[model samples]
Target: MFIESFLILLALNFLSAGGVNRPEERIVGGGPIEIEQAPWQVSFQIRGHHICGGSIYNADTIITAAHCFFLSGAWQDPRHYEIRAGSKSIKSNGILVKVAAVKVHEYYVHKENQFFVLQNDIAVVRLSERLQFTNKVQPIPLAESNPEPGTMSFATGWGNMYGADAGDANKIPIHLQGVKLRIQSPNFCVRFHGQSKICAGDSKHTICTHDSGGPLVINRQLVGVTSGRGPNCDRPATFSSVPYHREWILNAVKSFPQHV
Candidate 1:
């Protein structure tokens, strides 16, 4: 009986491991959007699979979450990544650009516990080649200041659409998706996530796994980078504030090899 119990436990562990490696899907409560509507959205992919969302910073720079490239206590190689831009769907209609370099914030940290903690969750990605600008592909302007509480914002990504209680067999959406979110009070956000983050969303429209590094925009200006959510994905999502780290982003872009 003990042997049988051990075998069952081992089987369960294997299944849990497999689940962790599965590619997550779209934003919870969001609807499909056209690429032209969010021309700066890009799919951050490893090999040929979509993993996270990013925004175009320029013809050659992409901004995303630092955690996207750091996992299991190690940073991922830049050569293994590519960006899919100018397309609404990850499966088709986009230009895939190779990665030249990735610059994660020096202070970024990942802590695991009952609730995961991510700090300074921002990164700059340099593309191997300059992207040709079109109506369906353009750079977004970074926010210069924080938006007041109750300001309406939008977040876009190809992340999981359901909460943790939902079954994993749900079909993954192929197109880009977006949700409307409201900025929360700065005091409330800083209480839990410190001052470098912004809090937004409601129980009904929170972001989920795979949305990391996606853009949170107010009036077409990039305001936040999707950071994380609560354990059940039912709380307001947290994002790395762009205005808080704008200087770092500018410096990272400038430091990249100009010829690349």
Candidate 2:
């Protein structure tokens, strides 16, 4: 079992008036990436600043970590900022939308219940306006169709350079932090039986930190949102399991609720 701690907030990039600031594009394992993928990759902003990477699904919603919302002492209400999806650079203009509302899993308990991100650390944000789909800015597929296990997956976010905490105070270009992890034994899932969750990353490499609330994508579909460390962030191996609360995810996304 892994230990739990405070759900910390780390900033990657903040949205600027021009758009977001991003870095160069890199692919994981030399796999092919769609040229239009930039359109769907998103960056979360608090009060129009403090960037956290995300991805768009439908015309009206984005999926990211609830911890970004949970740990922040800032952010009071959903406001109009920018949802830059297509641009490689966070500063580049892509799809800009206002944050209409947020619908985080109701049972999501951060600091207290560390092992399990109760209600699953998933969150949905409704945009102020519908986003225009472009070659680079379209929604990635969802895992609800059949969240793949033990498949090639990709993750992207702007957290840190290394040896750091989760939430930083800067936003670089929307970069891809790609690594290859497999869905290990559901029975092998540690700490309160991460049976409902999928374990990724090798025990010696490619773990998570500020990448929480990011995407655990497989076959171009979103299977899980970056939850947090099972025990600690530096454990070399971390788990980003899908929540068993499918009803909450599906039901809310089906109707599209509001969160801030």
Candidate 3:
């Protein structure tokens, strides 16, 4: 019972703070990520502050972590949301895309010991407009296959620094901070209470704070969504595995009304 037993305990211990998934790993060398002509990433505003990470899949849709605002009994309306596409600078990104709809997993439990850790953690946000691909902003290629262990990748966000002085202060990247880490599995990571659906950080350097909802990039293809920091971003990155949620993403795309 991965979700029922192991996941339950982890949710109780870590998710008690009310955010996305977490863990640690070794970072690929190069200090911080060097800016290249890469695809556009997305960020969301929660409670007047940006705490969520996401990526543009199409002109009208963005993918993010479901836990962004999914707390039992107190979740806020997902309307009035925003997404920044082109630029890497969190404060000065190019396009500020407005959201038209927010779709979360219907079976999401937000509970302990659930069998579906990969199900409810994924979400889709429909944008009110379509985007023209640009040098600094473009859609990342979707996952073509599940990442095998030891596959190296990058995760980016403006969520928070592992040691944030004040909440949301360490968030919102002054500059895009990207770290390289390899993917591990629940085989041994779950011993420390991780899920099988996530790629464990190599326990080297932590993923940066502002990286939630950001993309777990591998070989230039989008692999995972930065769901949560593993109590420390300097460790390995924990993610909501995109490979395991392909059908869910397709359904969300299909279920979206096109009237807008």
Strongest candidate by TM-score: 1
Residue-level lDDT tens digits of model 1 in 37-153 = 899999987645666789999999999988777654456677767899999988788799999999999999776554466788899999999999999999999998888889999
Q: Which stretches of candidate 1 lie over 4 Å from their true place?
A: 1-26, 164-171, 187-191
Report the alpha-carbon TM-score of model 2 versus the true structure.
Answer: 0.70
Model 1 vs truth, CA RMSD: 6.6
Clashes of 3: 29
RMSD of 2: 8.6
Q: For residues 60-144, could you state the per-residue lDDT of candidate 2 as single tens digits?
A: 8888766556433234345533466665554446655767778877766543432333335567788887777778778876666
Per-model CA lDDT versus the true structure: 0.77, 0.51, 0.58
Deviation of model 1 at 131, angstroms: 0.2
Top lDDT prediction, candidate number: 1
- Look at candidate 3 and tell me the lDDT of residue 176: 55
True lDDT of residue 17, candidate 1: 24
Model 1's alpha-carbon lDDT is 0.77
Please give the ranking of all candidate structures by lDDT, highest first, separated by commas.
1, 3, 2
For lDDT, candidate 1 versus 3, the one ahead is: 1
TM-score of each: 0.87, 0.70, 0.77
